[model samples]
Target: MKESSATLRDLRPTQFAVGMIHVRRKMAETRAVCADSRYAFMEQRAIAVVRGPGGVLHVIDHHHWARAWIELGIERAPVQVKMDFRDLDDIDFLAAMMERGWVHPFNERGEKVDIGTLPPSIAQMPDDPYQSLAAFLRIARVFENPGEFNAKFAWADYLREHVSGDSGTIEGFAEMLATAFRFAHTPEARALPGYRPEAAR
Candidate 1:
């Protein structure tokens, strides 16, 4: 079956209800896709990090892609809608982002010295622990690109269990995640996946 990125608004009431039922069934079958592992070293503690000055970070798995509750005077059933990644043109979204100056292209990771430069307490690692965790999570299929995203939070929680200490690692790990997300949300960075600078704007 082909996947589509069509939003819930695109579906009629009957189609939306049926899609929601299917989605709910799928969600109920899996508890956690990215965060669970039998390997003792792969565990991570869940910590809420502030995104903006007052905004809290919310991590939702790619599942639950469509369907949001609509409230009307405290009476509402969640409006269930179906969506598929295939429905979206990744290239178009990337192009739009670049024009808005939300990303920078061709910047190598090595050039970003500020990325891994957290304070000591927040930067503790088990000798390239991020790499190890990335490998583990990759095998478990936690993230699409292990190298693209840092696994410091998982590593820190694992360290805390074995090392028996509070190194304040979570804060620094959160910052690292924040940085990655910032880059992704940027205009140039977003273009990497779908836009060709020489061909189009």
Candidate 2:
């Protein structure tokens, strides 16, 4: 319940794939939110982080919002320490995080990588276009919200097999979303999280 402000540069990402953060889209949304004083309550929804050894604040979620805060030139934002693993040694801490499903080591290629290779900062995270697609599809109700456990990665992996190419433009992404939306209800996507049965559609 104890919350405080931390500089955007001080947070560390627990995962490798930033594919969910469409920079332009997130930045635009963040700008709008910050521009309005009425929405100042967002400051109360702090980024969830854990206190790691050496006083590192490992971010557990909200990677996109944190990145957008940085992109929008916001110096510091609110944070809540969901856990404090600073008591554990590095090995134990990482093991605990993995066991609890709090850490994801997969890279942009969706290949599991060494946790040590995770980016040092939000800015260093790599873009995964499929992440964006997955989030968009969920928002568009192409499928239900994939629950938090590696949800974006699961959708991204599902999309990687069916969709191709990456474009930052709205038109290009709209086309891809259309393709992904159609594929969402097919048998191929049945195994994916929140997959809708064709009969249910």
Candidate 3:
């Protein structure tokens, strides 16, 4: 449960879903590197996991990177155990995780989900297109991280209200980006974790 290697397939996902576009982008980037280079790349970014009840490993961060590794057919990746909550029961364990912002119990539609029902692995995480939109907004510098856990997700939750559907094309994502930008600066969005009014200019 320390700094060591683990099977990518065996690591449990703390969240129910992720921005698959982000995961796909990482997959493409990782695929471009040579085998040895990819090994070094992953080595440098060892995934951080938390040892939960029954000694289950739950990824706390870098979900995109972890997903990319598995999708690329890499068998193993380095992981570090940041916390050990195996002593706590399920209820107490979840509470402790939330207290430290280590769990994401949200799903594809941005609705809160039960952590017990989360996907067994990142490979199975459903796509939250709105989650992708929130990510794209950050990449475009339209949404800046407010130094909080799941900041993009908070924005995604708000975007879920006004945006829906994905055409699954470059042009379509661009259009969605445009639509999201209009609301990214609105007074209502000001309450979101990544809200920044000055960036409206």
The numbered model that scores best in lDDT is 3
lDDT of every predicted structure (CA atoms): 0.27, 0.78, 0.83
Candidate 2 lDDT, tens digit per residue, 1-201?
Answer: 588889889899998967544655767766666356613644655788999998899998878778877777888888888888888999999988888788988888788998889999987888888888887876666567545565666888888888875457768877888888777777777777776564336
Candidates arranged by lDDT, highest first: 3, 2, 1
Compose the digit string of candidate 3's lDDT tens values, residues 21-132.
8888888888898876877788778999988899988899888899888888888998989899899998998899899888888878777877788999878988887878
Give the range where candidate 2 is weakest over 10 consecutive residues by summed lDDT: 33-42
Candidate 1: residue 79 Cα off by (Å): 45
Whichever of 1 and 3 has more TM-score, that candidate is 3
lDDT string for model 1 (32-53, tens) is 3432441121112111111211
Clashes of each: 10, 1, 0
Error at 126, model 1, angstroms: 7.8
What is the Cα-based TM-score of model 3?
0.89
TM-scores, in order shown? 0.19, 0.88, 0.89
For model 3, where is the 10-residue window of minimal lDDT? 141-150
What lDDT score goes with residue 124 in model 3? Answer: 92
